[model samples]
Target: IGSRFSADTFRIRDFFAMNRVNFTWIDIESDPQVDELLKQLQISEGDTPVVAFGNEWIRRNPTNRELAERLGILSTLKEEVYDLAIVGAGPAGLAAAVYGASEGLSTVVLDRKAPGGQAGTSSNIENYPGFPMGLSGRELAGRMTLQAQKFGAQLSTPREVVKLEFENGYPVLYLDHDKCVSAKCLLIATGASYRRLNAEGREQFEGVGVYYDATPIEAELCGGSLVVVVGGANSAGQATVFLAEHARKVLLLLRGDDWGKDMSRYLSRRIEQTKNIELLTNTEITRMTGNGHLETIEIRNNRTGETRMVETRAVFTFIGAVPHTEWLPEGIETDEKGFIKTGSTVMNSPLWTAQRRPHFLETSRSGVFAAGDVRAGSMKRVASAVGEGAMAVAFVHEYLKEM
Candidate 1:
């Protein structure tokens, strides 16, 4: 149980939701029985956001890594060397696992947090082929996870790769806890992260009032409260539409001239049809003010130079994304934006060591590949990520032949 304003509670909830863990949340502030329960457990209110495992035990304000360990989602490596090690659990990585493992390659997928990267947090994906109606991001991830596991692909969650090294010409991944795993072939699908909101006080209210994705957990918090959404992309358009279902009003602020230009046509139409959503073009948040939670926001029209204050308790941002390449080693060349350089680009890089040209999706470091949103020149679509992921496995087999 936890308070409504507890940032720790918000993070736990987000983690559980994104990881598809089924749990009940009891609001300590609103629930009357929480006091009696705390008394029975001999625990104080300050020790809230506690995770209880039935009546067996409870951890007070536990971290995500701790919870993941308790949940058995984090596993210890048993193999001395894996045939293929995928460094991400996103669409591309998961796809690779499914293909690699099924094709008899000893594959293991590791992710710092949970599976599903940025796309996994999406509320709904309508444009993806099949499931014409649509499917939730969590559902898509759950199915893929099940398929990968069924094909004997090992998935280790909450396992972050802190550093990379090459020992005996094989990539060795140094994890968060000084643990290391080596692989014959590696696929770097560490997808991108959403850019943070630049408005003042944005960091302060991150979990308190500001959010990144419009999942059901976040939408529940919107209940009758006015909320704000920022961005002009399809993700922003999706958030505005979803929030409109629970929020009293939704103010969508965009820095671009035309919202339809960046967002999907269907989502743009849905936003236009939604009565509660008000689109504010060429506008941006100037400041966010609140005592403990978000209370008000100051927005300005870039063209008009006029500013106004809007009362809101929540703001969701989906401006853009940056690749997760900071932990990557030097041999893997990257574009100006940090997305991994592959294919012909790797052949042109000075880091290329092999006499033969690098295979498609192969990085400058032979036997290492990149796919999904992290790859330079990627399509940045779910279907494309999946295809690239499967295609990368083909190159992995070719690389193995050379070995």
Candidate 2:
């Protein structure tokens, strides 16, 4: 029938659902046409979320960008050389690609998952500049991706960078599945990821009912049902407001008593104003239980030694984020928390031995730059990341001159 155990399936569905892409979902077990279609496609039992395009069927789950490539909507990575290569598709990397290409540089952007990075997952982003009425994270990211592509920047998604190797002055980035791409200058803007709640049964019910964002898919499924949201950040606050429109009631759990401590003033006020969103301060989710999907959650009061259970099928976590810099080698300088160190900050390190000083946003390794949330001491905002991405391209030009 329908299965949510596979991560790839969830990713494809999430991408399509968030973008409001129209498609018919056929459950194999429930629908009679599945058996005949499966036979026609010659798909095995394990092959799920099989995509049928024209007279062919792709018997595997694919990311949004991968799906686009398969449908001929996105061009493949045909060129071998690029003036600048960006290793992420977030605001920072996308900005760099846009400016780099518009300025007549051959640019190639690679992302392991999809465009927009962490900021692309939000249901609403009100603080980003230029949009007075606010916009969904998906919409904002989509527009940025389009703009970058329109400027002649080529983007390849679901493409992971396995390692970085230097030859002469070129930074050659190796991709997964033994693929590789080389560029005169490189930028690391991989950004960060959400930290999952470490409660019991967390993995068992991950996609079934537990989630990291409050996208429209969850809102549609959890309608008239009780829902729980953990964390006090703006992302958490946004999810609460969005879920309030569909869920019968939303339980906003916070480890600390003051929600305003970690969240923005505007989001705090909006959460306070929403009647259906109930705030549960000094509480944390300790356990989760369900048959196949989440049915209830066990919570504990951090301040008081009291424990209780709450009935809910859906729980969204928007806690702290951890940078994605583990793939980087030791030569690249990083902070205690693994964020990249750049510019004058790298000059103090023993690894920096170049005659000239490092440029702003330039990493310890010459001709390399870090931007967005991946850089140490960076502002965690979409606008700031975009600015950094665009600025990094300028530094690339400067470094190319010296080479």
**Best candidate, TM-score:** 1
When summed lDDT is taken over every stretch of 10 residues in candidate 1, the lowest stretch is 71-80
lDDT of each: 0.90, 0.83
Local lDDT at 324 for model 2: 95
State in Å the error of residue 135, model 1.
0.2
Error of 1 at 219 (Å): 0.8
* lDDT score for candidate 2 against the true structure: 0.83
Write one digit per residue (lDDT tens) for candidate 1, span 262-310: 8889999999999999988899998999998889999999999999999
Q: How accurate is candidate 1 locally (lDDT)?
A: 0.90
TM-score of each: 0.98, 0.91
lDDT of 1 at 54: 79
lDDT minimum window of 10 residues, candidate 2: 1-10
Report clash pairs, candidate 1: none
- Tens digit of per-residue lDDT, candidate 2, span 198-269: 899898887877888788866765789899999888889889989999999999999888768988898899
